[model samples]
Target: MEENNSFSIKNWNEDDRPREKLLLKGRTALSDTELIAILIGSGSRNESAVSLSQRILASVSNNLSELGRLSIPELMEFKGIGEAKAICIAAAMELGRRRRTGEALERKKITSSNSVFEYVQPIIGELPHEEFWILYLNNSNKIIKSAQLSKGGITGTVVDVRLAFKDALQLGAVGIILAHNHPSGTLKPSQADIQLTKKLKTAGDSLDIKVLDHLIITEKAYFSFADENML
Candidate 1:
């Protein structure tokens, strides 16, 4: 989608815009689109950097994984994405993927929602699309195994409850923690999120496995169903 607005990012309020927001509120405060806009720096004559970045992301169904698969030529096909902009995007996406891969090679214990965020943020926090993951923990709350259950859950309904718990049974995990990232940078749990957490909790109960928590992760913050007494 080509943005018809000719206004620049500068036209927005200093505090409200991506560049200034990052400076004032820190990097974690900006959304995925805003981070991409910062990398590309400027948009074409008819689009703001933010708009061009949004259009680029929209082309990939807002999946950063899809965006990472694009070649420079493929990214350049967009109206405002050029060779330089494409290169910048390509580099950043590569770094993000590498960082996630490196982190996933190790295991971490889940002591709290904040701990879950620290371990999982590099994997999903900055993506343009939603992802659901399950952390299967041994009796001591140490992570023994992890799996990606679903690729899309912006509405919080795409995860399969059976699939999420199947590995817990195989791994002989005593407990499980549910986690998924919100690309929109909102920490509020949707009704679907609540329902999904309840559904999974109910299923885990019959198997004698505990559902410890469900964390809704964002760029900087997270919402914990267990912490809020929602689960």
Candidate 2:
């Protein structure tokens, strides 16, 4: 007796091809490999898109989760993935990451350092330079708005006290939480940090806006000026 079956992309049936399945059934109906095949676009001269995707995944340890973890540079290490595909993969992952984080933020009120850190950490965690952000708050302590105020180099960061107050006035904010990332990842506030905080606090005092806290963030950690009694 002879038993036979065909499983090549050519034999996947008209409805099962990635393009056809995507158009007819929607992308969710496809497996991880199928989704990756669509991203990969084409295959080697002898291989199909599905086969190339499978090979790429296998090179990353046979798990899509592992493949997802690879940075753009790391993903480009695989054969047949040039700059375009590498950027596509990285962009896709970043979009997914932002979506998940945004969902979490939507469910919570900004009430504590942890909450502010959770929101602002992602916005500034990977910056090569320093970024100063101001989180404006309403009467009940809910967030009114958040804005990046300034950016600077390793030693000298500048924040215009008048400009910061102007934004607070524009937001009609009753209070604010100031934050900046330490590219060096140190939570300790420098003397300059204290000087700037005092200036902003003084400006807020005059304008009847409370300066709630100044948060210093790093990729691995954060610091709160209020928590350390610096405010």
* Candidate with the greatest TM-score versus the true structure: 2
Candidate 1 residues lying further than 4 Å off, grouped into runs, are 1-89, 100-107, 153-157
Candidate 2 Cα RMSD after full superposition onto the native fold (Å): 5.5
Per-candidate clashes come to: 0, 0
TM-score of each model, in listed order: 0.61, 0.69
Question: Lowest-scoring 10 consecutive residues by lDDT in candidate 1?
Answer: 6-15
lDDT of 2 by residue, 11-127 (tens): 664324898778878888988777887877876667777886777777877765456567788877877777888888777767866875696568446778888888887777656
User: What are the lDDT figures for the candidates, one per model?
Assistant: 0.83, 0.80
Candidate 2: misplaced stretches above 4 Å? 1-79, 104-108, 154-156
Q: What's the true lDDT of residue 146 in model 2?
A: 82
Model 1, 126-170: lDDT tens digits are: 777899989999998999887889897455438888877778888
RMSD in Å for candidate 1, one decimal?
A: 10.8
